[model samples]
Target chain A: MDIVIGVDIGGTKTKIGLVDQNGECLEQTFFRTQDFPNLTNYLDQIKITSDELIQKLGKEVNILGCGIGAPNASSKNGTIENASNLVWKESVPIIEKLKERMPMPMRIMNDASAAALGEMLFGGAKNMTDFIVITLGTGFGAGIVANGKLIDGYDGFAGELGHVDMTLGDGRLTGLGVRGGLEAYVSATGLKRTIMYMLSKYMVESRFRDVAYNDLHGEDITKAAEEGDEIALKAFDYTARVMGLALANFTAFTQPEAFILMGGLTNSGKWIMEPLERYFNANLLEVYKGKVKLMYSKMEGKTAAICGAAALIWEIQDKPS
Target chain B: MDIVIGVDIGGTKTKIGLVDQNGECLEQTFFRTQDFPNLTNYLDQIKITSDELIQKLGKEVNILGCGIGAPNASSKNGTIENASNLVWKESVPIIEKLKERMPMPMRIMNDASAAALGEMLFGGAKNMTDFIVITLGTGFGAGIVANGKLIDGYDGFAGELGHVDMTLGDGRLTGLGVRGGLEAYVSATGLKRTIMYMLSKYMVESRFRDVAYNDLHGEDITKAAEEGDEIALKAFDYTARVMGLALANFTAFTQPEAFILMGGLTNSGKWIMEPLERYFNANLLEVYKGKVKLMYSKMEGKTAAICGAAALIWEIQDKPS
Candidate 1:
């Protein structure tokens, strides 16, 4: 059976996996991308890992294609433009670079878009024709699907749901140039800020204050909320409200079939999903009230990224030029 | 060339026209719907007019089909359920009734969707595969085209752009029960309300104060604006700002090739169009900026609606059940 090698490149770690036509993963592996000195060495390690996975899965499983998902990846130009997270010094022609070592047709897309494609292919939204996949990790991101097709605007940068206006606070004068946006409230930084604001109001003691800036993760807050913490619940509720309002604004025009939520904060499960679902329904137009479903990804967290990356490549190849 | 009869049934009047494949109106006629005592008489008038037009055009132009466009047309059901404006109290099996007289294939569709199809076929958006047609008549309405096709959704009521929130005044609400929508400022009702609000504040007035609600039209306001009226200009600017923000919100998701503005008020031309175009460009997502074109429809006034209604019928016949 023909298979595709899917790669998910991040600042800290890089994940690789073999995906079949049915979106089933055969063998998956991971390595620290930061360990490599440069792009060449990093890609060499990836090739070695790919070879190992192929050997384990049997050499008869021909690698038909390769798909890579990364920050600032441009599907139109087939390049990975300089990303602040990655150590790369210059724009990298990812498709061309991968061709030299692997010798197969390849495609690369933004990680958020890949995640959306993954949700469409193997996640809870497998049967949905129109939906938006939102990633709430370090920063909020989204991939939009309309009329059963992925929307890549003139510049291949169509889905920017996070950047849409949501805030009405004094902190609008931040790094992001936009006036009001969803990213201001839903991202990891946004959650940290929310926690800090709450801390000033209440004399609370928690593990969050100790590792506040350096090593604190979004999951810690979710865990704290799971233990019946009020502050954490407030933060989650705030994020869900803004996300829901933004989704309502989006549904006004496209009216998608569903919204698929992912990323680290989504692990909060009902703490985040239930409120988000409620607010989204409340804000929806009467005709669209009971139409859109809110779903969470069922695939293992790691597999979702790679599967999404693979789906991006598959989708690009299938579309008419 | 084969010809088709395109019938546009409005609340107060009915227009019947013979349209060719090239979208040319070979022969046309109109009559006041109030003249007919009942739907039977109204339909008989249409039959008589159509037969006369067909006879005048001669046997050389064979009528191949018929298309109808109305307010509450259900493409799925091939009938126009009772429209609020129309006196018809029961569902009109329009196609089945009209078919007996014409002896040709017939189809029916809602007016807004038909307008979208008309724009796609012969208006300013002729060559584009993806775009939106915004009708700014008594009420604000829209028909969206994405991925080269109109979105019918699950219930065939997909493109409802007017009801989306605009967030102007807290008291303003959409037909869907949402507060602060585009229709609050962009439609004919919206413009009149805006003018009335301005009248309470501004001292300058020329002709609007004594005008009857029925006689108050967008053209009168446009004429005043052209004559250098301050209140008219302010009203246009305020309307433009609201429309611009709404357009920005829409382009954030479904980045259609263009937004074609139609209906009565769009005749205000540069007064409304210039400011709206300016604000749309200034506020759009940086990536989507300049990608979407704002243009007026080549079909203006009642003729466009007739054409749009006709196109709806043609579209229904072309689609498979």
Candidate 2:
């Protein structure tokens, strides 16, 4: 059997896995990402983790290559450029360093793109040729696949779906200095904004009102909704409605087969999916009505990002070079 | 000297031409499309024209094949289904009909898609791998090319830029019964709407005041703008501002190398391009700030569509089969 190394580099921790073609992680481990503040230190830790995994899997499987998924990582440039959350202040040529050390075929893609590839290779989108995958984390990000190939664009920053402007008026402003961007209404941050607005608008008492504004988090709101809180429920409905309308607009542009959603937001389950389906179908054009499905990522905890990283290698082989 | 036949079928006229590999029309002729009411009559007329053209150029050139560009044409199914402007009420199997009559290699594509092929083959985007060609006529249309191929979705309607929803509120309604679509703000019909709104807002007396509301046209506004009409200038600015912002949103999605503008609106020249460039730059994301260029189509009138039709055959040969 052929095995591949999957690496998911997060702000606080880095997860490494020995993965097979079927998206199964035979063995996996993690290290404290924050412990290594600089680029060299973090890279050294990655090398150590990879070497340990290779030594254990070497006897049973032929190692194919390694796939790394990183935030702000560019596939075309093979560099992680100025990731705000990471300690690396400058662009790190991670792909070059890996190639020099291991001297094998490897690829580094944006985390969202990698997750999309994982969905196509191992999750619900296995049978779909054209689809969209969105990771609604602290910030929203997307990976768009058209006609069975990921859209890398000329400079490799093609799938910036989160930044698409929805309106230009006195709506919410984004980190990118744009007003009413999709991210301003359809992300975890956006959901929190919705929660704040809901709390202010409705006079009804709720558990969310007890928490301070700065202390509130996404999970707290989800928990509140799960516990049958009205304000929280309305917040979730607002987020899902905006997201569904954005998805419907995107559908009009590319007419994807489905939209695979990952990250913390999907944990809301039917709260998100149910309202999303209603708005998506309502806003979709006549020809595309009821055609595209909204699906949640099927990969289990912690493994989802790791599986996506490893799936990148498999996806390269699946597509025509 | 390889030669190909290019056919551009319009609602009123059909232009047929024998084109060379260099995108030069060797010979051309046209016939009134309204002369024939049914698909059979129009197709039979096309066969007759092709025979005549071939007979005229047979001895001097090596004929390759034929290419046809039509409205609401689906390259995937090779059928023209319910084209609103066309007289044919039912779906016409255009490709099959052409194949049976000519017994040669041929392909049919949407008019905008064909025009995009023409631009790539003979215009400013000759070296661009990813770009968009937008035709702003009676209706707005788009042909998206990514990784050096036209994005024909699973159902052959992938690049519907015109129909992309621009707003979620009670904005301009499109002929297709959609609200706030890009076409509702950027096409010839959209321009007329802009003019009417401008006339109502400002108390300025101009040539437009003398003309009846129903008799007003897009050209009247442009001509007035040329003669220094304030309302007309505002109308053009509004159209450009909205279109530029939409292009910026599209840039965030696909991040194409350039946006090539064609059709009647390009005749407005700097009034449109200047504002479009300014707004496109302002609304663009940081990384994509100076990357995507907005270009004008190089293919001249009458010949442009014809060249595009013939270029479809060449495009097929260029791509790996």
Q: Quote each prediction's TM-score.
A: 0.81, 0.87
Candidate 2, A109-220: lDDT as tens digits: 8778898889888988887778888888756778888878888887877777777887743378775667778877887778888888998999888997888877888788
- For residues B1-321, could you state the per-residue lDDT of candidate 1 as single tens digits? 677788877655688888766667777889887788587788889899988888887767866677777765666667766454467754778778776766777767666677888887767767776777888775677777766677655445566666665541234664445677667678877888888778778888657777766677788899999998787898999888788867766665556788888876787889998999888887676556678888777875657777776676555556685
Q: What is the TM-score of chain B alone in each candidate?
A: 0.84, 0.88
Residue A276 C-alpha lDDT in model 2: 82
**Tens digits of per-residue lDDT for model 2 on B165-273?**
7775448877566677788789776787888888899998777777776787767777898899988888888999889889888886777999888877777887777
User: How does residue A33 of candidate 2 score in lDDT?
Assistant: 77
Candidate 2 Cα misplacement greater than 4 A, ranges: A1-3, A10-14, A29-65, A82-106, A168-170, A314-321, B1-3, B9-16, B27-65, B82-106, B317-321
Largest lDDT belongs to which candidate?
A: 2
Q: Score the docking of each candidate (DockQ).
A: 0.25, 0.51
Q: Could you tell me the TM-score of candidate 1?
A: 0.81
By DockQ, the best candidate is: 2
